[model samples]
Target: MGAITIQELTKSYGETNVLKGIDLAIDDGEFLILVGPSGCGKSTLMNCIAGLEDITSGELFIGDDNVTSVNPKDRDIAMVFQSYALYPTMTVERNIRFGLEMRKYPKDEIESTVKDVAKLLQIEHLLDRKPSQLSGGQRQRVAMGRALARSPRVFLFDEPLSNLDAKLRVEMRTEIKKLHKRLGTTIVYVTHDQVEAMTLADRIAVMKDGIVQQFGTPYEIYNDPANRFVADFMGSPAMNFVECIVFEGNLIVESGNQRHEVVIPNTQAVIDSGLETVILGLRPEMITEPKPHAESGYITQMQLGVQVTEPTGPDTLAFGEWNGQEIQARLSPEVGAQAEIDGEVQIQVDTGKAVLFHPQTGARI
Candidate 1:
């Protein structure tokens, strides 16, 4: 029962407010991830949750207890920081057993716990090595083992894998996910890496400027972002935004001397907004090389003049100008190669999957 509830939480440094009235409820045994760019107050929020920083105002509940004023050690939570923070002179076994030893656990119990955690993290063979003798990934695993030795009510990880290389980061991510499944403890993880948040989180809280932009599952955040900011933030290549005008019930996209009308069915919100111009958001994958099945009513096909093509093994990315704005499309590597040599390609845009945003407010229409 490690459920956490935060209500109207605020944190400030003198006149500067780092967290502004944050409210969130994380269920018991759930993996909740707080993700945002640097300086978005995610780390501050994590600190507040861990009792390291005092909240300016608001109530915080861990499980059934109000732990707003509780000391970090008394909060029954273990934290794994970005830095391994292991003792340079101490062996891995001692580093892991240090927490249990401080609590006065029996020597046999500490040794058994260290062995079990080491096996779980696959670092059992490295137990006799010091921090200086281990690789970055190995050190990170040792840090995790140190935290895992304690059966705490909650686990806090603050960019724990940021120090590792890309390949090692991915491997460690899988290990973390497996650990979460094996031990169904509540976790509040903070990371600036979107891939980590997307892959590991049960739910992600996207933040910006000390405010939560949206809170939902990875699919919801990626497929149905609340606004342009969220839509632009989640994707790899980032979503493309094009400004266009609304006429009748269709959006008019003007490219050079050619004009194309994209009719958006069931667009009551856009019609009621009474705005002539709006922004259209589309993912690169949604625009692709034309196929026989691309002639649907909701699909719009256009010939694009190829400017550049980049082959990235799985798929090729084609870039060109649309309405004087740089637009990108994900195409089959074979088709993209042929299009690059031919100087033009036919691509289909799935307007049914397109999103509209209010240009002034950046909110979804």
Candidate 2:
């Protein structure tokens, strides 16, 4: 059975429509991530789901119960906010147990729950410490512990790890993933972090301007984005888009004084569409230093004037210009260093791996 169902969910703030007819169903134990830029209605949608904000239209369900009209407290959900809202006067244990205590859970049961959650979060030793004494990561964990101790029907996390430093954020991300594995609870996590969405979600909902642009598994979202907006949003360094003109069912690109045309094999639909101008999307990794042993296929080679190079430990990012637009290629540090000083580089383009988009609509063609 689905753990949560949102049907035609809509929310507006006076003149602004925050969410527009959003529909989603999350299965039991699934981790669904809502991701987008700021003011994209991710948080508003979350607030609606938590019953903190009344919907402008539509219905929501948790388990079998309709929760659109249900009170936040009565909905059987736990939320971990970005700001660790730990009680100033309460010790970590008390903060974690306060919810249970408020519900009049037996003292012994509350103590056991706190102990279990503390042990799981590896904060057993810090239970006696106040929130002021704990690190940011520790306080965030306590906030999480407070929610985990409840064993609610659903977990809502609104950028819970955003406040932590990069290292601690990664650690907490792994911890949350493990915690979800053990508890198997339905989770609705919201974040602007693409890495977090890619690493943690069972499926990702990419939103833009108050609408979901794409909703699919991480692999699908990454490899097959619905539109240029989604494609540009998900990847680090972003996908490089190069404008090209179609000539005799082949993509023709001109850079500087050179012009190269390559046939786009197997994508007949795009070729048959009678589109003249198209944008080619290629990931940095797909354009790399040409290897001597690389097999000959439909690969296209382009000569570029190296503009800049950034060495990011594992790989070096080489930047250049193609058809008057900036292009990036990922290459080995050794090769990148050599090209960096030379001011020129030979880049091999895997044309088969390239994606085509309509320049006007930004939709995959």
Candidate 3:
């Protein structure tokens, strides 16, 4: 009954539109992440769902009720902010019991809820401490405890881990995931961190320029992007885009004075598009050192003039140029140790995982 449904939701500020035609749904107990860069309307969309911002158009349903026009408190949603909005003077236990007390709940029931939430979040030991006395991670746990005490229909997290340090953020991320599974609560989380979205979400909605660029599972969004923007934005080092010319059912890539032909997937689709020039999208890991059994129909062996090499512990990143565009390849540490800078190395390109996009429009071909 905690499921949410949004239909063509739109929000604006006078003449400026923030969220445009957003349609999304999440089943009860699902963890949904709204992820994108700043000013992409993710936060605005979250606000609209929470009843904090009025929508210009569209319908929003939580469970079976149309709560688009309902007040924030009446919507049965709990929100956790990035800033950890905890009361300065109140003890952690008092903070968690505040909302229930305001609603005139039985004193014993409020005490039990607070104790249970504290135990679930592992903040039982810190219950008597004030917010100022706790670390960033502990304060965040308190904030989460406060939200859990309400046990609302939906939980909204607006960049909850943004203030924590890197190590603490990872720990908190795992904690949040565990909490979601244990409580079986419908969660809507917002983050600009793609890694966070990938790790924490059951489904992700990538937004940009006031519109949802793509919405899918992490694997689909990472491997099968809707457009060039989604492909470039999701990955860590980002996907490499090389300009190539389509001719005779192959993509022609040029590096220096050499020309290499790469087999294209969906030959008929590329032919039907009738676009001579296209952008080749390849993830860094797709381009790697040649293997003994790597001889395959879709594999193309090309010589790359290595310009720079970066060793990042487990894997090394090699930078080279393809068709005058700089591209990166992930190499094994052993192979990278022998890679000479400013020298040429043979690389195996996997066309099986390659994606084609229209050059001018940036549309997937």
Candidate 4:
């Protein structure tokens, strides 16, 4: 019953359009993450869902109710923002029960709800403490508790972990995932952190310039991107887009004056494609140190003078040049790509997962 349906939703402010033709359906108990840069209208879309902003056009339905024009208080939703907006003067107990009290719930019922939520969040020990006395993480829990007391149909979180330190952010992210599993409420979370979107979402909607670029599971978006921008934006080190010529059914990438032929899964697509040139998308993990006894079937090598090598404990990152553009290779420490190493490392590029895009349109080939 908590499902939300948005159809051709558009929001504009005078001459500027913030959300352009957004169409999305959030299923009950599904964890959905909306991610993009600062001005991509993710937050604006969240506000529209919560009934805080008036929609300029289109339809919105929560469950079976047409709540597009409903007031914020009437919509069955609870929101937690990036800023933990708890009352400074109220104790944790009061803050948790305030929403229930506003809705005229009985005193005994409110107390029971507070006890249950406090146990769920494991903040029972901190109930006597005021906002000023608690740590940032504790305050955030209290804010979430305040929302949970409402037991609404849908939950909205607008970058709730962006304010915490790195370690606390990781901890809270796990907590939120656990909370969602326990509650099984529909959630629409907005974040600029790609890591968060990948780890916590059942599905991710990547946005750009007020448009949703792609909507799919994290694995699909990462491995099988729809276009160049999605491939470039979703990865940590970022997928390297190397310009190369498509000649004779083989894509070419050159390093140190030697041209390397990269194998494509759809070789016929490249052969039939009228494009003489295209950009090859390769992740750092795909390009690695050549295996000592590695068979040479589908893998190819690129010879490059090593520029710099960095050890990040688990793996070594080697930076080098390909066709005058800087590219990174994730190398095994066993491959002797240590820091200050001077020799050229023969890095193997796996073409199984490699993707090709048109140079001009940035569309997948």
lDDT of 1 at 337: 98
TM-score comparison, 1 vs 4, better candidate: 1
TM-score of 2: 0.94
Report, for all candidates in order, the number of backbone clashes: 0, 0, 0, 0
Alpha carbon lDDT of each predicted model: 0.88, 0.88, 0.87, 0.86
C-alpha positional error of residue 363 in candidate 3 after TM-score superposition, expressed in Å: 1.2
- Each prediction's RMSD over C-alphas, in Å, is 1.8, 1.8, 2.0, 2.2
17-93 per-residue lDDT for model 4 (tens digits): 99999999889899999988888898899999999899999999999999989999999899987677899899999
**Lowest summed lDDT window (length 10), candidate 3:** 336-345
Worst 10 residues of 4 by lDDT: 334-343
In model 1, state the lDDT of residue 165. Answer: 80
**By the TM-score metric, which is better: model 2 or model 3?**
2
| TM values, all candidates | 0.94, 0.94, 0.93, 0.92
lDDT of 2 by residue, 1-365 (tens): 33999999989889988898898888989999999998898878888988989999999998888988998999888998766689989999899999999988899999899998898777999989999999888898899899988978889998887767888788878988998999899999998888999999999999998888999999998888899999899989899999998877788898779998865654576677789889888889888988777675768888878999999989899999899889899989998999899998988988776778899999988
Q: After superposition, how far is residue 189 of candidate 3 from its true place, in Å?
A: 0.6
Better of 1 and 3 by lDDT: 1
- The lDDT ranking, best first, is 1, 2, 3, 4
Candidate 4: where are CA atoms >4 Å away?
Answer: 106-109, 119-126, 132-138, 292-296, 334-339
